[model samples]
Target: MKILLYFEGQNIIGKSGIGRALSHQKRALASMGIDYTLDPKATDYDLLHINTYGPKSLQMVKRAKKLGKKVVFHAHSTEEDFRNSFIGSNQLAPLVKKWLVALYQEADHLITPTPYSKKLLRSYGLTQPISAISNGIDLKKYYPDEKKEAAFRKYFHLSETQKVVICVGLFFERKGILDFVEIAKKMPEYTFIWFGDVPMLSIPAAVRRVVKKDHPKNVIFPGYINGDLIEGAYSGADLFFFPSYEETEGIVVLEALASQQQVLLRDIPVYDGWLNDRMNCYMGNDNQEFEQLIRQLVEHQLPNLSMAGFKTAQEKSITQIGAELKAVYQEVLERPYDHQIYAKVTK
Candidate 1:
């Protein structure tokens, strides 16, 4: 079937998680030999896979449904994930959730990145068929590179004695940026770097204050990075420290794992099914625990964690994700047009 994989506000979300997700989906679809189009005017398409929940996307969904075309919505944003994201996100969350329910309920099928996010959508009163799939990583682009790492270290003027710990995400409270800074303060010996940018006026006042404040000498915020430099950062960092409070699925975590770096994350419910403490990653609930874990990781007390993470990442490789997506698409096409029954069966 020809699928129209469309995302609205692509320019607005540039280099953001949603943008990366759209890019990954395109690559995955192409790798699976799926015929897809980004053009909304394409008449030959059998399905419309909407990735954004904007007004335009909503209008397209309505038109597609009226035309008897299959409509699949990608659940990238939930109220829970929206809170603490920007200046008015918390105040706007309830309305956003209500709007999402209205939009997603119109879909023939729904796909989210994690079971945790799927559960959140159900809680938001969405009755559409929902499935969880990882927004898989490109192994070749993210794997370890010793030469790149060396260059990265030299470029940053980092000494070999300093163990670099990295986190990548937008500068938002929900991403645990404050917690990350606090941890950096507690561990002065390790060099901490956060790779992300903030839309100047969009961030909350509290988050902006933190960004403007003088952080610990060891901490650095170099803004959003991409291409070879990003790969270099992933490879050069000794450990990946992501204490994000929530995520549908963290693509950067997968990239770090593919780079064969040991990951340390907050012990949140979103990672319940995939990540295990001391197995594929290290988990902590608070700053003290994070500090202890970092100490152990840097001291070589934790062994084989990086290799284990790499192995875990392989399960969500681009090839595997492509196959899963293809299966979901085929199943949705074959199913009868009964939303209630489809929702019940998928749940």
Candidate 2:
């Protein structure tokens, strides 16, 4: 069956989690031998899978429904995840939640990154059928390489002996940027680098202040590094320090695992059943604990968690995710079309 996979406002999402997830999806679809198109107007496609809820996507959904095409909505954003994301995100979160609920209720099937996200969507009172799937990692793109590591270290002017702890995400409060800065302050000896974007005009004043003025001397905010350099950063860093307070699924964590870097993360509910504390990663509840864990990792008190994490990453590889997606599409297509049921449920 032909499928059209599309994300509205994709160009604007640049280097963000949503963009990365869409990129992974495209690769997965191609690997599975699935015939797919990015063009929404493509007539040959039997299914429309949308990954965003912008005005264009909403219009496409309505058009697809009218044409009797199977519709699948990929849940990449929720109200809870939007808070603290940008300048007005918190204020606009409730409205966004309402909009998402209305949009997702119209889908024939819904898919999210994790069970935690599924529960959150249900909490929003969406009764539509939902499935949890990983935003799987591309192992070939992200793996340990000494040559790349050396080049990265040389380019960044990082010394051979410096213990580099890195976090990759947009500079948002929900990502634990403040906590990361605090932890860096506590550990003056280690080099803390955050490789992500912080659009000066879009971020909140508080977050902007922190990114510009409040950070510790050792903390580095090299905003919006390219994909190849990011791979290099993952390979070169000693530990992937992600103190994010919230996430539907932390794709960077998986990338770090694929690169064989030890992970340190906040003990958040989103990682409930997936990341095991002290097994594949080190989890901390607060700043003090985070600092302690970092010290433990640096002083050789903790075992190498890279292998365990790598195994988990392997399990959630793009190839496996593609198979799951292909099966879901087949199951969806085999069933009878029921626009009446969709209309009733949406109403």
Candidate 3:
């Protein structure tokens, strides 16, 4: 069956994780030779795969239902991760959860990036069948690139011998930006670089203060980057340090693992199944532990787990994800659409 793959507000959230996930979906579909269209208004598709939960997305869901088509809602955002992000996000989180519940309940099937997220959605009391699929990684784009690595060092004026730790995320409290800065302050020998940005108007004051003024000399905010620069950062950095407190599934973590970089992460539930502490990656509960681990890693006292991490990445390749999506689509298409169930939930 033909599928309608749609992501609302591509121009606005195009650089966000949800946006990147949509791109990965498109690539996966293309690699599998699956027939799909990005147009939400297209009437020729049998199933609609939507990634965003905006008003336009709801409208599209209604249209798809009227056309007797199945809808697969991708749960990329949750109230837990929505809190502590942006200025009024905490205050708005409860309302956001209610909205998510209503929107998600309308779906024929739901897809989330990880099992952790699927559990979260179930707790929200959604009745739809949920599948946990990885956002997957493009190993070709993220693998060790020697030329790009050298250029990254030269562009940042970083010496080849100098130790560098890198993180890629928006300047959000939930992303552990403050903790990253605090760890950077504790280590003067290693340069810490954060490679993403959010509009200053949308950021919380505490995060804004640290990003704009309160950070240490060792810390650098190069802002949002992609293509060669981001790939280079993954390859060139001594460590890929991600201290995010919450996530559906961290695409950056996958990229880092695919690049064969040693990774350090916060001890969060989202990584429970795939990531093993001190195995494929290292996990810390607090800033102090993260600092200690960083020091140990730099001193080469810690074991190199990059190869093991790469193996994990290999399992989540685009081809595998494509196959999984095809199976899910076929299963959904084979099932009868339950109009009575939809009406009961909405009522």
Candidate 4:
């Protein structure tokens, strides 16, 4: 069957979770032997699989329903994502809410990538049939590559013998860039790198100038990197640090683990089943704990592939997740909906 996939935006395709999600979507479509397009109006398509609770995809969901097509809306975050993003203001709030509520009522299927997000979506009036499908990692693309790994290390002027640590995120308040600054100050010997560029966002012109100058050197903000370059960076790094205040899913943690590197993931609901303290990573409550883990990984000499590293690779790859998503879409198309509420499903 044909399918049309809708995302809020695919800007520059940076090294963020959304970028990885889109990559999985593209690769999975190729493997499934199904004809697919990004076009919302492709007449041959049977289903429209849209990601997130964003306004753009919400509108796409409404249009797909009007055309008598099957609709699947995946929830990547809770209602807080809706009220805090670019649409938080009064002018766009009603329009964004109107479309999101429509997706909740009219879409034939719903999905959330993480358990934390499943609870979040339920709070947004999503009472229809829904399931949890955790995000994916590309095992083949992300494993340890000595050649590329060496090249990346030489390029960054870091020695292969010295352990390398990486932190990647768009420079937003929620990403905790300032937290990294604190972590870096305490542990100066370990190499720390930050990926993603903040100027990409459409913030007010006035604020842009101030944020541009704030990028410091020791933190190593190298803007955006895509394609083989990303995996190369992952291959060389000894560990990945992701301490987001709010994230529905942490795809990079899976990438790092798949590449045989450790992760210091934030202790949150989305990361519950995956990360274990002193196992896959040192689960952190705050900056002090993050630093302590860094010291442990540095001084203690943690063993490589000690705690079911291959098992993690087996569980969270693109091939595995794509198969699960295909099942969800098939179920949505083959079954009839018991409830379809056009009015506001919740107060």
Q: Which candidate has the top score in lDDT?
A: 3
How well is each residue in 237-283 modelled by candidate 4, as lDDT tens digits? 76778877777776766777777776777787767776666666667
Q: Top model by TM-score, which number?
A: 3
RMSD of each: 3.2, 1.6, 1.3, 3.8
Which parts of model 2 have CA positions greater than 4 angstroms off?
341-347
TM-score of each: 0.95, 0.96, 0.98, 0.85
TM-score of 4: 0.85
What tens-digit string does per-residue lDDT give for candidate 2 at 1-98?
88899898866884788888888888889989998998888868888889999989888887887777888899999998899988899899999999
Predictions in order: lDDT: 0.86, 0.87, 0.91, 0.68
Model 1: per-residue lDDT, tens digit, 118-185? Answer: 99988887876799999888888888888888877887899887799999999989999998898899
Q: Is candidate 1 or candidate 3 better by lDDT?
A: 3
Q: Under the 3 Å rule for N, CA and C atoms, how many clashes does model 1 have?
A: 0
> What ordering of candidates by TM-score runs from best to worst?
3, 2, 1, 4
**Which consecutive 10 residues in model 1 have the weakest lDDT in total?**
338-347
- Cα lDDT of candidate 4 equals 0.68
Q: Tens digit of lDDT per residue, candidate 3, span 1-347?
A: 78899898887788888888888999999889999998767999999999998998888888888777888998999999999988999999999999999888888899999999999999999978899999999999998999999989988999979999999998899999999999898899999999989898898888999999999999999888899988999988999999999999999999999999999999999998999998899999999899999999877898999999999999999999999998899999999879774564443
